[model samples]
Target: MSDFIEQLSPLHTVEREEITKAFREVFALSAGKRVLFWMLEQAAIYQDAFAGEATNSTNYTLGRQSAGRRLIEMLDAVDPRFYPALLIAIADLKTIDLAAAESLAKQQEGEEYDVEA
Candidate 1:
């Protein structure tokens, strides 16, 4: 095997500490505000997926399917070609951004403001 191929191994395991440091270093080299905004977007997607129309449609449903089939279902909402990886992963987030979600709902309704003043 070539030198490059000799060192390459699929069994390589990255330590948690090293992964954390690498993640932080990557973000530090770029803009923090953009990442923050990206986080908000992920939160909105999460809210819509878990609490909005998406959730309602799939609620109280039980079925069994292979992991590949489930992946295709998630891909329906998010295109893997565009978003291969999230800036701030939200699929496993415990909470949603209510403010961001509310704003998204309003934008979809074509109403500027619904507050009665």
Candidate 2:
């Protein structure tokens, strides 16, 4: 009994419960949402590692291509329906402009409300 308990005690029960809870949260999300968030996180990592002052260099291009290939491989493991949404989300993330987004938000705040229209 002691040996059996020791063999299974690598992760304490509390740690296992925490891991189970994290998995449940991930499982609760729609497949598309999961893929979108995963791709966005991957993109940020790639940008930080490869899209710096040498972004236009050949090495950067190669690194970006490799990261894109890995992203596609990851997407292939999930439902096909999520592919388009994930692609669009990643593209939008890549092209997003913070300044333009802030300006647009400010412009909308000054607009009159037109719920009936």
Candidate 3:
């Protein structure tokens, strides 16, 4: 649990139910939707982390390359607890592709399974 999560406890009963509904809907989404959900969350997280940083053309390219590598590392890890990851995944009957009521599965090809400045 986090202080941030605890802060959400102030929500009214209806609000809490709505939040749970969000999870339920997300759980019902398909693979592509699940991918987009996590991707958008990552975009928001990165934007918050570096919204004011200065950068040059050369460094921007290098930074993009680094981000790609790290993204692959994360996807391969198959664990949301990895440092830079979606806080929770939407679960379905088969498996929770990305935090829902189902189990978390491995990569599509196999059951095989980080961050920096």
Identify the candidate with maximal TM-score.
2
Query: lDDT tens digits, residues 39-62, model 1?
Result: 444434323233356654444221
For model 1, the stretches where C-alpha displacement exceeds 4 angstroms are: 1-14, 43-117
Q: Write the residue-wise lDDT of candidate 2 on 60-117 in tens digits.
A: 5676557766655555443344456555655665456566788788778766453357
Estimate the overall C-alpha local distance difference test score of candidate 2. Answer: 0.57
Quantify all predictions' global Cα lDDT against the true fold: 0.42, 0.57, 0.46
Deviation (Å) of 100 in candidate 2 = 12
Looking at model 3, residue 9 earns an lDDT score of: 56
RMSD, candidate 3, Å: 16.0
- Clash pairs, model 1 backbone: none
From the highest TM-score down, the ranking of the candidates is 2, 3, 1
Lowest summed lDDT across 10 adjacent residues in model 3 is found at: 97-106
Q: Could you give candidate 3's per-residue lDDT for residues 1-117 as a string of tens digits?
A: 356556665556467567456544543456544564566445443343343455564466556556655654544343444333332433342264233322333233244421233
